[model samples]
Target: MSVLNETYTLSNGVTIPKVGFGTWQIPNGDAAYDAVTTALKTGYTHIDTAYAYGNEESVGKAIKDSGIERDKVFVTSKLPGEIKDAEEARRHFVETLANLGTDYLDLYLIHAPWPWNRIGTRHDEGNLEVWKVLEEQYRAGRIRAIGVSNFDVHDLTNILDNAEVKPMVNQIQYYVGFTEPTIVDFSQKNGMLIEAYSPLATGDLLHNSQVQGMAAKYGVSVAQVALRFCLDNGVLPLPKATSEAHIVTNAELNFTIDPEDQEALRHLSDSAPEHFHNSTQG
Candidate 1:
């Protein structure tokens, strides 16, 4: 019973795979191509990428070359977040489709509340404008689901309070150490599914002795423990890996962690031994 066979129902009734193959820093050419191709061959039914990742073309090409039915794989991408205007939002959405060579997307997200360099500047009204564009595309059937990423409660509230359609997903920088209680609770409570980006904390969690101990108890790797931790918390994890071993092993979540140990992991004093915590990045 590998978890790769499992799926989660979104707020709008669209089903996405529980595990997602992430292509964040994988680069555009062979790196992204090979990783996405390997993930598909290894039975990954979900793929998450973004305009900021700058690898949608390669990711899409890999999926096309994999010989898998387009609809069989759940695909997700995001708007660059800086484009707060409706016109630019529409333009980027079209560009994303062209880059992926797909007419529609399983899911689409606003990459962030504000641009990367302008993190603290919450463009609430601008975000609302973009959200409305997303709502337009979603209603037109170009995107099966619409959502946001890296959104705190305040940013998400802008959409939830005024939009005709609420966000269906919120992709955040979640890991064992940073549970992001406020945003996660608000999103889930509002019927949005949480997708965890950097679930392994960019390889930081691989060295946590506490997590390692739990992995040892389960006879799995530290990555497996981290991935399962997200699932246990009702968050879908998007793990990025390039090697075939890692791409395959990442989704081989066949065993369940003990309830007691899970609680211990959730409340760990440190999630990754000084490497990763809430202050690291989001």
Candidate 2:
């Protein structure tokens, strides 16, 4: 089967496309629309966007223009990180649906445990309020599955302990040279699929000579090796690309890394000289 057609079933039995086309840094107008349209043309079945990304309208329009049935494609969007009120979350979900020109979302997520500006502040109570709203929507069939992004153990545990429904997924930053092993292990054990944002590490891995050497052995781009690393570790990868060429080739994951090479890739997590933290996780 083509990698594009492969999927991971959410805990709720919702099937999500393995490679989610991300619309993170893209602008809201023609850029977002054209990129999404290109990805769909190149055979990506899953599309990931966020309220914070400010391109939901364009992403939705691109999907509509692609001529694919809505059911044939899986769509996901995030609730803004700042929304802790139940009513606000509810209202936003409606707005998201309208923006997408759809009736139900394949998946929806809390953008983060805390607002983007207040990253580390504890929001146990507030997060619970948002989760309740997500739960309400999921139960109502408006959302097929619900999850979170950028949530660590403490954030996830708060919701797990307090809510009737556990988050079905946790989207985090995972790449060849970076990972949150503790959070990954904890969330998976509790039945959450880890969706990896920045799976390409914001194109940073492409400039690494060591990573380039490794990719040369497989005759695959560094991006493919990085994406396959996420898949091998059982994490879904959401990669963003604007050019048609990049979007087409990004989905090509027809090769696998041997155990020894995979180990070398894992070791780079700590040893890699430079790292970036300026990108948003939505």
Candidate 3:
């Protein structure tokens, strides 16, 4: 069977596709619509988007147009991080459902512990308030699973300590060089799955000689090597692609990296741009 057919069960017993298509830079309208349609047709069952991405409407349209059953596709969206109040979180959740033209999302996430512009400013009390709203939504069946993105250990602990529902996943920048092991370990230990975004390090990993060597050894694209590395380590990789070839190639994960190579890939130094830290560190 194709790897795209595989799944990982969350702590809540919700099954999510192992590989997901991320709609981050893809804008709304025809561009986002076409990209998501192409991904669904190419065998991607999981689609990741955020309100911050400004493309949920197009993403929803493509899924509706694909002629696929809604239950077969896992749709994920994130609440805007600026929402620190329960009422605002509830309002945005409804808007997101309307934007996606869906009554319930497969997964909903707090985009970040802090607002995008206020990275590193730990807003524990505010995040807990937003998380409480998420818990209410989840209990109401508006979301199948609840999670957080770009959250660090401190941020996650704050929620875990006070949340009625623990986060099921923590999406972060996990790649060959930039694997935040401390956070990854904490999430896993606490029964939260680590969803890896930018598994290819946003195309920077392709240039790394070590990554290239592994790709050559496995006879796969560097993108494939990077993604498979995440999968092998039990991380769900969300690789973004607008092209059909790249989207199709990303889900082709039948090859496995040798154990020795996996260790090397894990310890590889961070090659991500400086701005990535500024944007992702929460």
Candidate 4:
């Protein structure tokens, strides 16, 4: 069986595939449809999209046309960053459900604690309000799991202090050189999973000499090394791929990284040239 068949159980007992296909920066219509279809055909069971990605409708169409049973494929979408009120969140949730053509989502997340352009703005009360709506929908069975992306400890603590249900996952910018040990530990200790987005650092890490050296040593693609690093460290990785070969290669994680190599990867500093901030610039 493909390694895609492997899974990680969430806090609430929902089973999420260990490797997920990410749909960030993928335009809607044919591009999104084709990319998603390729991933599904290549054996990826988890699909991560967001309202911010502007491709949920196309992602949904591809999934519907693939003839895969809905239950077998775990679908995830996120609320827009701008939605900070309970009513607005409910409205967007329904719209997302309609756009995806799914009655329920396997997972849904608050795209960010603050709006994209205003990353550090205080939104604790606003997030709490929106989380209330998510809690309501989750209880009504409209979503199987609910979470937050880009949330640090303060943001996560706000929800934990006031909400009835705690977040099941915290999706963030995580990879071999950019791992946030503090957040990872906090999430795991509190029964939440950390879903690593940009596992390739948006393609910058692929060219790092250190990463390339490790990949060459292991006889795997640099992408595989980065992703396997996350899995070995107990974080789920969501790697975006648009090509069929890459989609297939991203899931072939049957090898292990030596303990010492894993430690070196874990200790790679955020100040390193290949870190997330340096590579994400336009």
Candidate 5:
């Protein structure tokens, strides 16, 4: 039996499980399939993957193998940064749906603000076209909600300015460290739900004094402290795990940090250790 459970409601009234299994580095093989199966058996209902990850097919297979109904789980996939134009974006959507073997996506995100390759060479202009295309999909009921990832306040504002349908979610790299205060507040003020990836600071804060102290005080792991910070701060956190222990441990984050502890954690963000995003890690 699984014990980890937390949830948040998106701007579109969709209730998303706050804690999810992020398949960022889980390779598409027996290990990947086993990891996902373990995560679901351990009570994870949210699965986050991307076309760039090249494992959506395996993820779909894993879910189907688990005997879990499609609607019982919340799956999120992203558009590869290279396909940023309307036509390519439309093709990307169709491909992702086919790969995942799902008719409708619970949530779909524009993978990143930084476009890749030379497909559509107009920078953010391609993103706008992609957004409109996704909007059309949402209106057609192929995608339940549309959102963006790695977008700053400027990118979000630009979309809002020209979009016929407002984005319901913004998936960003947020943790107690690297809070991105302006973007966080701006999204909240505009009624957009912020889904946090790398919310554990990619494991950088697992042994920090603040988090460790809170963990010792609360009798939980330091990761739980960091996860509690994100959840309590109103950011929906999706921490990745390839093992069942981590999947369960990451979900066992329903603890609390008092006001003083929360403040200390916030202050520690300034002294955040190096490689905050783990960009250097292989």
Candidate 6:
């Protein structure tokens, strides 16, 4: 199948692929390395990983194995919440590059807004300093783009207020089941891209009745319905996979969803309960 490659123009003129291979739950080593290799060979030009994920070496190995030119792929990673201070943040970026076997990243994000009081509380006021450091990295060309993840409207606005280089993207927990329109609207207005992690709801919404019905009408899988839902709404979807079949399936997002179906899914989000790692156990 032909790979679906949609591009988004960042505020600074860098274009990133709309569909990225997310490596959140995947661990470090052979398995993770295999997944990254498969994803790249299957035509994924964008890869999303994090310092917290502990799989950068595996991802690096896969990229090396593919023998593909490094400039062709857009690689992204995050600064851990615990390392929010400037010196630690700078140190973390260096270590992240060493692990990924790259000198610079396509994008880098503040993993979260000081969650768990690791850097500071989510409501803490020190988060702006962290964002400032990331902004500096972007200016220095060490990181091509800088952004944040898991930031709500308030956390984002705080950064915007103090930032020299506006954030290029905001990676967040958004999907068919837990869509946050407010965040989308706010980010787009400011020219920051919204990268929707868990775009399939971590498989929680794959078998949902609404999703299933939509898929049947469109003659696609429920997973496709959810992924298309994100793409249609302008949120770049990052789907995870460790196998060839899953990677290929995700790359087949070239078709458009029906207008009525898109509207229906938007309404469904208002009533659907949230599902993720944190909510699943509760």
* Model 3: per-residue Cα lDDT over 66-134, one tens digit each: 999999999999999899999899999999999999999999999988887777788999999999999
Clashes of 3: 0
Instruction: Show the colliding residue pairs in model 1.
Output: none
lDDT string, candidate 2, 1-282, tens digits: 789999999897888999999999999999999999999999999999988898999999999989999999999999998999999998999999998889999999999888878767778888999899999999999999999988888888899889998899999978876777888899999999999888877777678788889889999887888888888888999999998888988899978899988888877853233756523331
User: What is the lDDT of every predicted structure here?
Assistant: 0.90, 0.88, 0.90, 0.89, 0.80, 0.81
Q: Is candidate 1 or candidate 6 better by lDDT?
A: 1
Local accuracy of candidate 4 as per-residue lDDT tens digits, 92-184: 999999999999999999998888888767799999999999999999999999999888877888989899999999998888767777777
Where model 1 places Cα greater than 4 Å from the true spot, the runs are 273-282
**What TM-score number comes out for model 3?**
0.97
Global CA lDDT computed for model 4: 0.89
lDDT of 2: 0.88
lDDT of 3: 0.90
Q: Identify the runs in model 2 with alpha carbons over 4 angstroms from their true place.
A: 270-273, 278-282
TM-score of 5: 0.92
Candidate 3 regions with alpha-carbon error over 4 angstroms: 273-275, 278-282
Please provide, for model 5 over 70-130, each residue's C-alpha lDDT reduced to its tens digit, 9 standing for 90 to 100: 9999999999877767888889899999999899999999987665443223356877988
TM-scores across all candidates? Answer: 0.96, 0.96, 0.97, 0.96, 0.92, 0.93
Q: Which stretches of candidate 6 lie over 4 Å from their true place?
A: 1-3, 116-120, 123-125, 270-274, 277-282
Worst 10 residues of 1 by lDDT: 273-282
Give the count of colliding residue pairs in each prediction.
0, 0, 0, 0, 0, 0
lDDT of 1 by residue, 1-282 (tens): 679889999988999999999998899999999999889988998999998789999999999999999999999999997889999999999999999999999999999888877776769899999999999999999999999988887888788889999999999988887778888999999999999988998888888888888899899999998999999999999999988999999998888898999889878865755553433134
Q: What TM-score would you give candidate 4 relative to the actual structure?
A: 0.96
